[model samples]
Target chain A: MAVTAQTTKLDARKLRADFPIFEQTFHGKPLAFLDSAASSQKPRQMLDAMREFYETSYANVHRGVYQLAERATAALEGSREKVRELLNAPAAREVIFVRNATEGLNLVAYAWGLNNLGPGDIVLVTELEHHSNWVPWQYMAKKTGAEFRMLPLDEHGELDLGALDEAADGGNVKVVATGLVSNSLGTINPVEKLVAWAHERGAIFVCDAAQAAPHMTVDVQALGCDFLAISGHKMCGPSGIGAVWGRAELLERMEPFLLGGHMIRSVRFEGTTWGELPHKFEAGTAPMAEAVGFAAAIDYLHGIGFDAISAHEHELVSYALDRLAEVPGLTTYGPPADRRAGIVSFNFDDIHPHDVAQILDLEGVAIRAGHHCCQPLMQKLGVAATNRASFYLYTLPEEIDQLVDGLHKVKKVFA
Target chain B: MSDGLDSLYREIILDHYKNPRGHGVIESADAEAEGQNPLCGDEVSIYVAFGEDGETIDEVKFSGRGCAISQAATSMLTEMVQGRTATEVATLDKDELLEEIGIPLTPVRLKCAMLGLTTLKVALHKAKGTPLPEGIAGFDELDLK
Candidate 1:
């Protein structure tokens, strides 16, 4: 095999310096965190942003007439604008902050789904969705007597569009929800095509962009989806903060998911009126510091630029695929490297994924193993679980090298 | 090999994992129960046939798919429980099983290590027509610490 040095655009070494967690070692080995799909490590800039906000500008948002409250409110809303720019959303009012992507997706299912769906209506999703995207719609369908259908995957782990026609039959398909990327298989799904297909059928499309928004360029308008969800922690941001972007018309028509202090206009004995667009959705005190940290994470990504990040990750994943092929009895799932994103899910021989992951930990090569919250997909793939090594902007080729080396070690131990 | 990996995947553990003993189901078993770890989709089913006296464990078997720690630990449990009465086996704890495996396991892996004992305890209690033995009966009850 011709092993060529792949030139990459992102300065990973420089970027790695910005993340303090990378400075540590695990089990006397350098920490090669390959679990970015679970959560990315925060950069110092993002951490500092949260710290600064808590120290100087900490106050409850959308309340209090004092200047401190106004400043706090502005900072929180400023993060919303940053998210708007990141997603290329039409208006800031369309972005609703929630606890995380799970909450965001659940908000859509509860607020929009409960109101619109009923008996004979079909809620269509794909088998490639994470639990966050799959479970909410399933629960909604059960509650509303709506028929829940999943679009099956073809031989290549791609969405079987032919099956979509049959699944969405009777012209009763009301909502189509799917992830833009498969978190387990790392297949970059054809969300744009799916959006178009759903729109033609007079059905609304909801996208789970938890994987895509962080790794690639995501434009809500370009994708033409009615609703989209993203998690802040998956990007270089803090946890406990995520957003769901919906079209203004759709958001306006839907009811508030959680009714509390901030989401109301005026509470009376008779009844309470709801607040404006996005604010109506974000109930109770928001994750102020987390929101600011998330925005800072976005700024950090933007500073490096998405193009370079994609290119760097492309090189790393491709290199990883090549190196992983050298391991005997290893079988990778999903499409080719060119077609997929940074995730690589595979199994070595009949070795259980848990065993493989445990051994890899000794080498300080962190990866995710198990069903990856996609048990249905695992069943479809005819495996109980898989081992996944996902890359990100700061992931170095040497880390992939270390991962390959660890796999060799796993072989030795099992041997 | 690193000490951590070596201790966890000791030769005896891997031996059982590679060539698991009592790995087939008994036909029309007197009592049986299934155990599953929902977190990783690991499942184990234990089948037992009581002795003529209906007190001693006459035959015990397990059929499942999981990591080495789980399968091997269960295999070890099968060997340890042979000929022991239901009440004697009922007293078996996770420490006994862990001692049999001869390794210290992290809290997360401890669940895998204890799946065998959990399943055996559940199967015995179910067969005896008694309520489940108190403490650490379910996979969720395993001391993750």
Candidate 2:
């Protein structure tokens, strides 16, 4: 495929028409949603697909021997194929449907981490990980009597990978987990290098792509990580649907974390055999309608090419940072705009983040406040919380203007 | 500012937040307790001194750092409880202070508005060696360490 300028520039104003939520108003003002990092607004295509699926093709998948069941099964499996393609995985069976990114990480932590990690083993993670990626490994280490370690962050909020030499020295590092993108600071981690470093130490790497996959082109083969997790809701899909893409050999060797109906090949008085690759991990009834929505979301993103999606956000963040610097007493966290994705985290003057969020809410701007579930990072940054404004494909430059205007209003309110 | 915001951050509230009343610790206090909203990191500490009657609160002071609502409400609470009995302060309604705030708050901000009153009540409960007064929804979960 040849790269063209047309394929790399997005019309955010036109794309806003596809999301109906934009039509609504907050406080009688047009809503400027800057919270896409938390969850993206669903497009009509995804909503229609889910509603249409439930109305027409709803049935128990892989069990009922009927036409509707076959169609439902095909639809759900089609989503797996979409997810596989989304992650650029080699096989669809390696992608296991999970509740969300958190559950996906937990599945790997319990199934793979518990089996592979033991005493004298180290599970190393980065300081920038969200609680989901950080807490599960802590729990796993506690359960298996393994030691837990963290890769500290530099003053610029980027991970200090240099520390890994001493941490992984002794070659006891069993597993290394990290987020490809820092959810709080918008720091784009050097995952490929980290993956190579982990492999050199004879360790498996887990990539939390919850923030990266939705915004960039993430290829599992290129990342060379053992497992990668993502949430559908963060990418304009419905909640309650996510996936974990793992290496086939590793997944095949790991025990199934959940058990019961739909994941059993045979059940008997003596013993029962588990189902095939992905089914062994996905227990109980599947999220049929949510899967349909997720497939549509994948199609929606593909329709607006990742190249254009990222380019549009790059423009927005660069513009936002430039305009934000004009506001006095505003300090932004993380590296420069070029080194980050579309997220911007900052604090204004001596004002509290909650107070800033409250004023912005009245201005019809929706952003996130508080620790953003990265308390360790916040403590390291010497702040209790921060105000975060994130962008996506549908976000407009005008909305950034709204955010800036709301910020000025905040300064005045406190002034 | 909009009507809703103006109401939430009334001039009186901002004044109290800027220049908090009784905003310090007592050298010799009868009871003291600290409260924090773990979610947002808002914190408040209350110190109380009993009157010679042993039932009346002779003086009350507070100190903390947080949003306008939390700090202002705590400042207002310190003034409202002074010269009141410990028993009366323990059973006092949250509405008394919320009305002083003069605005309706979201559940999260309501936690901020109530942080001061809750801490004051906790101090009274500890000083009296009595169980915390009941019937306030969403107040029990606050970490008072």
Candidate 3:
């Protein structure tokens, strides 16, 4: 879908009306939700689609010869096609449904890393990765006795690409795993370049696109990464559903992470053979309803257009940076507005982040405050925790105004 | 501001947070234990020096970083536990601490308020080999090890 400048300028106020959550008030004030990085509030279209599917065509898929079963199977498979189009993958078979991005990353670390990596091999990850991205590889390295190296972040919180290149020089690097965007810092790394560098070293690249897929467009073929993982809940879909898109050849070669009823071609006493590309990864009964909801979310985002969403978020984040800078002693993290997504993490003076979050909560402004599942990154930043205010397509400028005003109140309370 | 927020962040709580009591460690401490709220990354360390009797706490102090509720509660706990027997500190319950804070905390924030007390109990446990009194918020979950 071609998005013009006119489409890029979304009427977020009008869009907010479509989300039922906005209609409710907190403490007799409009809810200014700034925690989209944690999980986005769903739109009515997605809710209605899931409801319609369950109410009308609920059945076990790929088993019964009945019409309901056929419809259910079609819906499930059709969601895969939607995911393929969303990520611009080569085929639907490349899209495997998992629980969430954590599960998807774990699948790769178990199914692929166990089979491929060994003592002499090295798995390089970045300090910018979320715990979900970091812990799995760390566990894998420990299990396989492979050396695990972390690519450090520069002072600007961007990934040190020079350092990554130096580490990859050894050619012992078998896997290069990192995030497309830093969830805590909001720093958008040079993923395309990293992918090419990994390819040159004959190493497989894995992009944790959980944060990137929601805020910007992701084309797997263009990225040329071996695998990419995405979460549905962060992108306005259900929580228990996500997708892992891998190169078909690599996926076919890897062993199944989880084995059970549906992921088998045939079961016998002698031995059992695995099913096809996507189904080989998806074991047992799948999250059929959540996948349907995810497809509807994709349609909702497409209706808004990613180009438009990106532009809107860019505007919001730029505005937020300017406003947050005006708050005294507010030290923001990550690169400048141009290099980041819609996330702004900061700490106000010596006031603890939890206090800032609580004071903001009093004013009906919601934000996340903690280590944000990136304790190692928190240690790197020289802080225990930070308050994060993240935006989405529906976020309005007035909410940021409320955030600044709330921070002022926090300063007053603590002062 | 809402009354709920005011009650939660009372002036006394802010005062304790700003000018904390026993803010430094006891250098020649007999026993020391650290507690962390894994949810928000709030940490508290309790250091105790037992008296000649080995039951009375001669000196008690805490040093850590956390939210206002945690810091203030820790400061208050230091004041309450000083000169008390390790057994008394060990038996101190969550209600006594909550009453001292004089605020109604949500289930989640209760962990923050009790961080100092929990760490103290762990320290007392280490010093006197006394078990932590049951019903302290997050006592079981606190990884003092």
Best by TM-score: 3
- Expressed as tens digits, the lDDT of each residue in A1-415 for candidate 3 is 3323236577899989889999888977789999999999999999999999999988998899999999999999999999998999999999999999999999999999998999888899998889998999999999999989899989999988878767755549899999998899899989899888888778999999999999888999888899999999999998999999999999999999999988999999999999998889989898999999999998889888888888888899999999988888899999988889999999999899989998888899999999999988898999999999999999999999999999988888877
Output the lDDT of residue B30, model 3: 91
List, residue by residue over A30-120, the lDDT tens digit for candidate 1.
9999999999999999999999999999999888899999999999999999999999899999999988889999999999999999998
Give the proportion of true interface contacts each model preserves, from 0 to 1.
0.80, 0.60, 0.77
Per-candidate TM equals 0.95, 0.93, 0.96
Question: DockQ (Cα-based) per candidate?
Answer: 0.76, 0.64, 0.74
For candidate 2, give the lDDT. 0.89
Candidates 1 and 2, the one with greater TM-score: 1
For model 1, give the interface RMSD: 0.8
Candidate 2 on A1-415: residue-level lDDT in tens? 1223237577888889999999999999999999999999999999999999999999999989999999999999999999998888999999999989999999999999878989999999988999999999999999999999999999888999889898876649989999999899889999999999999888999999999988998899999999999999999999999999999999999999999988889999999998999999989999999999999998889888888888888888999999999999999999898889999999998788999999999999999988898988988988878999999999998999999999999888889
**Residue-by-residue lDDT tens digits, candidate 1, B17-92:** 9999899999899878788777677889899998999989988999988999999999988899999988888787
- Supply the DockQ value of model 1: 0.76
For model 3, chain A alone compared with the true chain A gives a TM-score of 0.98
Ranking by DockQ: 1, 3, 2
